[model samples]
Target: MSQLGKFITIILATSTLALTGCASKNKKSQVMVAPLGVGHGGNMGGYYGGPLVNNSDAIRNAARNIQGVVYFDFDSDAIKPEAARILDQQAQFLNSNQGARVQVAGHTDERGTREYNMSLGERRAAAVRSYLAGKGVNTANIEIISFGEEQPAATGSNEAAWSKNRRAELSY
Candidate 1:
């Protein structure tokens, strides 16, 4: 081979080696979670950093269909009667799925002080938690986190937006 050809071959080998090393390093840094269900597309469906949920698409769809998380009138922690039906469905799902764990995240609209909003969020989450616990779901399997007014589902100052922001979201 000519000198130029030898130089190009060396460069290609070095590039290939560098790419291989980087790939191996990434593999070492990765954390793996055991999946609970098969993916619909036959590929793993969970994100890398977040917690891996059981990924029962049917159960997920059912949970999504139930609307437990609700907006209350401003500065109130009362659970509406309409919201109760949704929670009842969630309670049933949890009761049936013995191995499942869930996190109830409570959020509030930006109409109050941050500290006050945090307390309000906690109250809302606790209310749901208490209701679920009352419905024979294990208290240990449920975790509650209150984000207060820090994370808004909607980003506007109007009542319409604020109403949307105040809610509890369930995640597994």
Candidate 2:
């Protein structure tokens, strides 16, 4: 065979293999060149193997990737941008897991009177709950509790402890 012909055949084989990699993983391959609506024809095709995977599985995976806790600045109940994005991911999972319910417990550093600290804690928890709700998670699926200064994540009299204590914990 001529050298140019052999090169053309080699190139065509390489192109075929590369394009094959782009095709869906389904073993039933006829759907590749099938027309639009003809893609899912019973015997001829399957959108995704045997059965549809549970969407909740994806949601659970997303939930697992995110830390369920959100921290706040000193004496602040505002959800920071970074915190908001994590909460958004949590909200997506919560919305997907229809049977899932969670508790958002608010905590505060030991600086204010019990009454004041309790109020602050509640505000923090409520702030997280409200954010999740705004992101489309059912508010009814979330329960809010205020721990005030009772539950300190890190115990100390310093800013590190204060920062650690001032946060909301999401528990399943």
Candidate 3:
């Protein structure tokens, strides 16, 4: 291209960024991640680091469709036996990639108050975290967050939707 064309392209890009406050066009897929300490069942509430979650396209693509999600029953935080297989897979993936980190997001159906749902979400996330830890994944590479009822997986107030909503998603 000519210099004039290159100049115009740069100008347009700068104008768009200035108007939009420098936001990227990509969609964000996970929550903020804090690093954890390198130990299990510690005195630090079992958590161990950070202000943000930084992910590369390579890591994200590698973890894509790895079936790292575990669902839960309505109003329950217990890890069901059927979920063990996928949880073990997730743990193995993480253990193999020592530098890779994953975020565990807990979600609940809109069947209870916001406060109650939030607590349930936390429990669900913790349960998943514990399971991963037991499977030999480093606790330091796992971060947890609770989305509660705010981010339902499915719309509507039906059994199908509720069942889909009660899940914990692992994002790397």
- Candidate with the greatest lDDT versus the true structure: 3
Each candidate's TM vs. the true structure? 0.64, 0.63, 0.68
Better of 1 and 2 by lDDT: 2
Q: For residues 86-158, could you state the per-residue lDDT of candidate 1 as single tens digits? A: 8888899899887777767677898887778877877777778788999999977777766677667777889
- The order of the candidates by TM-score, greatest first, is 3, 1, 2
Q: How close is candidate 2 to the true structure, as a TM-score?
A: 0.63
> What is model 2's C-alpha RMSD?
20.9
Q: What is each predicted model's overall lDDT from 0 to 1?
A: 0.71, 0.73, 0.77
Model 1 shows how many backbone clashes?
A: 0
- Candidate 2 per-residue C-alpha lDDT over 40-91 given as tens digits, one digit per residue, 9 for 90 to 100: 3342211233221233455555556668889999889999988898898788
Poorly placed runs, candidate 2 (over 4 Å) = 1-65
**lDDT of candidate 3 over 25-68, digit per residue (tens):** 67442333222333324322122444234567787888885897
- Please estimate how well model 1 matches the true structure, expressed as its whole-model Cα lDDT: 0.71
